[model samples]
Target: MKRIKNYFTIIAALIFFSGLADAQRSPQRAPQSKAIASSEDQCLFNGTYRIDVTESDRLYSVVEDARSSVPVRDQQQFFRDLSTRLTPPDMLAIECQGTRVTVGSSRAGKITYLADGINRRERLPDGSFVSSKITLGVDSLTFVSSGKAEDNVNVAFESLEDGRRLRVTRRIDAQQLPEPIVIQTLYDKISAAAEWNIYDGDRVAGKMGSAQPGAPPESNRAADALRSEFAIWIEATNRRDIAQQMRFYMDELQAFYLTRNTPKRAVRLEKERIFGSARSVDIRAGEPEIVFQNGGRTAI
Candidate 1:
């Protein structure tokens, strides 16, 4: 258990060390959506995800009393002020295994522990205490915490019908804001790294790694299909079939490409020229991953 204690002690260090920002970000690969898991799937969050600050849509509100306090008009400033809580690391990570979950990012580094059994504060070297609790259920993961500077914190993650994205509502209690600030942080679920292993105590295990290939064939087929499609696309980099290739992108993305790149015919000609000059495109895919968006979309 000494090792476990040491590991958690390291986690505390990360929790405190999150203040330091480092330049340069590595590329992230997301798993395709399972897209069709049964409703009884309790382990929907059993993977890692990269979260970003997308334009807020339908999310929880922060204006505690819209009538009493003036609404925050300057969205950029508001988001900037709440950057620490909203987006510090361009890409955020959430790892959930069984009932335990860890949320990691640039600013808050990382925090990992049992979901239902954690309720304590870790005193940092700076003589300040960071306290938090995690409560996991069938459909939601609730994290409640507060620090020396914070009055109260509530960040809730709700699982949609599909598992591609989670609706996050964060409420930070700081005296700096006009009132309690509520921010909507929607996290698009992505696939974890292939060859990445999850260590449970001393028992070593491989997840989405080569060693565990086809361990759960049914669940992995969708992810595999996505990979296969990508491989095919790579091989066909010099492909002239615009119709077939256009199918590679989502409608929203296709529309964006058409608009941003110019006329459809011109875009096709550009692709042809680019691919025609390429010698070969290499496919460097790792283990397969899966994510199911609520609207029946799959992203890999």
Candidate 2:
């Protein structure tokens, strides 16, 4: 009987030790999952992007308004120049690692900030100091910088279009100005393997191929045909030819008009009404930028 009791005790001890070992190993797996979550969260904003010049130019009115507030004097000319040439960097490279975020560009060099909501100070070339802070949110990242003269700048990067685009809003506040200068710009994420074709009114102006193997010849031909079709559509819209414009869209098409979706027939009727009422239509369309996706089956 004593031998039997000893065997049971040994088995109970083994089970307890095995559970303790599992408990220690479970915490190790938790940290790895956490790290994976962090990486996935950062992936949304981590990539190279190019500024959408056409979209950015649409917001130039805000810059013009701000420029009017400054005088022609040298001290104030700086403000004017800033407003006039407030062009965003042509290219932006973003990197996110743990609590650190880095934004780099040819114009702005490189800047690193901690997303811990703590203000960091750095001296400018003129020996003046500025305080800057960065905050990371669920879907946006905000950065604010202020100087001793009560002049401050705030920049926010928002992820839009399911992380395919970024909208950057900048606000400049100065003590001498009555209102802050606000400029908003859009950026399109550049895929590493993207193939771009530039169109100039139904003519292929240029083609940019990725470093990887080029798409099949058939695929390229199909893409070129689509590009040409798009250019012709734009030409039709510019000339206010409702019939030609309607040819590009399918009968069952649903077009997004401002805030709501309208069927193709309604779209045609609306276009007819507008074209009929207007004395003259002089629509100038910018160069179309096309990004091919789904193995050249879709373009956006």
Candidate 3:
């Protein structure tokens, strides 16, 4: 009887110790796994989304209805010209992640948007990280955006994603509206996206370096035009004057760039910026690498 009691006592002690060990290890193990999961799970919005052409609509009828108030020209040629320009976007690519949003063609250069109040990490050569927060502002009313944006532009960001909203926004006056008009674009995701954040920095010219290698001579000419334009733009940016930047870009690009860097106040260059100059980023650009198409108007 005494031996049996001792044996039972030893068994109980072994089980208790085993339970305690598991309790301690479980807490440690769960959180490390959770951390890894969270990092991998990420935000669903963090990827490159091209317009699902079959599922996307540009809403040209909204424009036509608003413009219907304009006296319809009876001339057939005028009507034909008007019809040509109103076609829906055949292809649109949008990349959404953290704060950066890119809108344009995959082959062509894209307009980059840095959202309002999101942090981006810059890793130094020494393997230290510093954070810079970016804010995106949009001014839909302006036909011109020289780095600075003004007047009644609608700007807001809602991050809750169930896969039915757009991160970028804009507004304008239309004849059909009693008030200003607003448009929200929606995006869809792709399966493989190891390179979504390609436009991480350098909003002035986005990812032009990716396809510049082995570029033909004619493409070099196109790239030169882009470089010369950027030279003026860089000077304007250095001057801390939005108006100065406008001189280099086309009217469409100026508005798009300014709109993307929204809330106007956040994107300004300080008069006492510490950097004296920026290093020239080497680009091996070719014309085919960047394709821009808007109503049959094409450019590199």
Candidate 4:
């Protein structure tokens, strides 16, 4: 009886130790909490977006609306300052991580926000300062700015079309203004492969492709005019005429040169420095090829 009892005790100890080793080797995983899942859901706007010019309000109209309220004496100065503040960026890059969101704009630089409902003072590009707060919602992200004299601006961004498009709405209000200025803009999310379609009347006409279609008579004439203009510009460049080169661009022009989006003044300064430093310059430009787009109302 004693021998049998000893044999049973050894077997029981072996079984208990084996179970302990197995538990250490394969531990159970804790279920994910709801907070982590909600945090991930807030990243719907995480992508690069390009402004859709056709669907966005023109800057001229917005300026005109604001100009109506200002006095004639102050209109000129107010417009100068307002134009810089109201112009929308051409591209925006958005990043969402946890409760932090960062927005990078082509024109306005970059800004980071913590969506904790705390107001922070930030300086604008025009050197003016405003207190702003950013908040994240279920389906939209909002930014509100407050300035002096009851001046307030609200900007909201909402995802659309299954996150392929974004709608941005901006509202400006001030004590001097009788009515609020509201603007809505649309942006398209960029993807690895994208296609821009140009419509002609009721048909899809110019899809971006490698093959160049035969030019119409009107297109040929426009191409000739562009070539002539290009030749003149090239001549001016070789002669190092900064003023002549500058005449080719408009005041509101934004040129992408050397991988940077440079304004007209900066472009002029750069050209001036290059023209002044170089002793002899030889420039050769080929004939310009014009592609009629937007039903021939625009050309590229």
Model 2 weakest 10-residue run by lDDT? 14-23
Model 1, range 18-123, lDDT digits (tens) per residue?
A: 3211200112222223322223235565444444444443221333222222144543333323342343222345556565455654234455555553455656
Candidate 2 lDDT tens digits, 60-165: 3554445333344433334434443455655566666655565664243445555555566655445666666566654577777666433366778887887788
- Output the lDDT of residue 11, model 4: 25
lDDT of each prediction vs. the true structure? 0.46, 0.54, 0.34, 0.56
Clash pairs of candidate 1? 30-191, 31-191, 32-291, 33-291, 33-292, 62-182, 164-292
Instruction: Return the TM-score for each candidate structure.
Output: 0.40, 0.48, 0.30, 0.51
Best by lDDT: 4
Q: Any residue pairs clashing in model 4, and if so which?
A: none
* Residue-level lDDT tens digits of model 4 in 224-288: 67767889899998988888889888665543322234578887887887678888999784333
lDDT score, candidate 4, position 124: 41
lDDT of 3 at 124: 31
| Model 2: how far residue 159 lies from native, Å | 0.7
Off by over 4 Å in 4: 1-37, 67-69, 120-130, 192-300
Model 4 C-alpha RMSD vs. true structure (Å) is 22.7
Residue pairs whose backbone atoms clash in candidate 3: 108-290, 108-291, 115-136, 116-135, 116-136, 136-262, 137-261, 137-262, 137-263, 212-284
TM-score of 4: 0.51
TM-score of 1: 0.40
Ranking by TM-score: 4, 2, 1, 3
